[model samples]
Target: MHSAIPHLIELQRVDHLIVAVRTEIETFPKRVREADAKLSGARTAVAAARERLVNSQKDRKKFELDVQQWKDRAKKYRDQSGAVKTNEAYKALQHEIANAEAEVAKAEDAQLEVMMASEEAERRVRHAEANLKEDETAVTKERKVIETLQAEKKQQLDSLLAERERALAPIPEDLRELYTRIAKRHHGAGLAEARDGQCRGCGMRVLPHTLQELRRDPNEEIYRCESCGLILYTLEPVPVPGSASGSERAASSAVNHS
Candidate 1:
């Protein structure tokens, strides 16, 4: 056990380092995802504004065409009025001309309304387009930053993984497998320190004899906790204020019958 103690300590250090690396790598993509959502929303707004502008322009064009058609009809009626022979025919021509003029006036008013609406629509489209351009620029910058961060994180992770491989190289195959299995079950914390008569990982009290054996072994080999089956190590035990010593603590507790 004494011969394997250094290897166990090395393994613990490697696991801690890798855990830190994994955490940092996970955060890189979250930043880019947030930026992408913002960019997509901006694009949608721009598309809606452009659609409104197109409809407004179509309306304006139709109204202008109607006004021109009514003006032409009014001219025809005016010419007919001068050539009319009968009084009734002349009166009818005059009435037709008045009706054509009214139509032209109404058409003109419609055209004006459409033109005003078109102008407003165009203004909104331009504003949206500008906003979209700004968002695109921001997205580009954010993507570049994300790429840079990913590259940096990859390099760091590679280095840490290499160190982990080195640390595990000297450990026995069976021990390494046991450690890995425990790590998987315990969310990466395979080993726990027994301090103050307590297993740090699961908060279970360690027996006096178990603590004695752990302290006696100079080479710390892998040892499982009796209660939680977690790997345990003995460092300098921290004395709990007003708590009993190892022998006294053991004597006070009910023995495990099992």
Candidate 2:
């Protein structure tokens, strides 16, 4: 019957929603970050693939230069063979030319290997780039959605705050302060319903005297559960036929006449 009880209950309900909304708002950033991380990983993969392609191209270029140098060496040895007067010198020059040609062939073979690897690297780069773009687009879209949701939640929070202020208006300032403190300590539910002489918040039994006082007191003094420090409230109990305060008990207690 306390004037502040209904307002406190409304305040608790609004606070509960506020806490949930705030918790959801907090997770939005983490969720967006997770999406960004995925996009970043895709970008890294593309970069690695491009680096491999570049290295493979460089290797191919080195091999091509090696082949050109070996071909030039063979050409020089062939020209020197014409100037050689001794048969031994001429044969030696031909042998040198053969070695140079072998070197050129070896270089070409390595160049071909590098070309193949470069092609594979290029393919991977293209695939990774495509994946990166897709991931980036997806993340961007997701972020927009998350941002919209966050804005809506912020608006909702503002409305709830205004509603909470309205709820507090009907409550006495001191009682409102006490309720707010307790609600903060107990996750936005400072009051507990008492049913069948039990504190629902802490599952503790209320004392008989306390229960009687709660039911019979006209002053509307607030009661709190000793175990959990939560304000306790009770609904009016229904009268029974045979129990205490019932018609049957009253009749049995009445003095009988002869």
Best by lDDT: 2
Off by over 4 Å in 2: 212-218, 237-258
**Candidate 2: minimum summed lDDT over ten consecutive residues — where?**
249-258
Poorest stretch of ten by lDDT in candidate 1 = 249-258
Screening candidate 1 with a backbone cut-off below 3 angstroms (N, C-alpha, C), the clashing residue pairs are 1-219, 2-219, 5-220
Local lDDT at 105 for model 2: 98
Q: Which stretches of model 1 miss by more than 4 angstroms?
A: 219-221, 237-258
Model 2 lDDT on a 0 to 1 scale: 0.87
lDDT of 2 at 207: 93
lDDT for model 1: 0.83
lDDT by candidate, in order shown: 0.83, 0.87
Given candidate 2, what's the lDDT at residue 78? 96
lDDT of 1 by residue, 118-206 (tens): 99999998999999999999899989988898898889889878888888898888878888898888878777888888999899999
Best-fitting candidate, scored by TM-score = 2
Write the residue-wise lDDT of candidate 2 on 125-234 in tens digits.
99999999898889899999999999999999999999989988888878887887888888888898878879989899999777766665354577789999888776
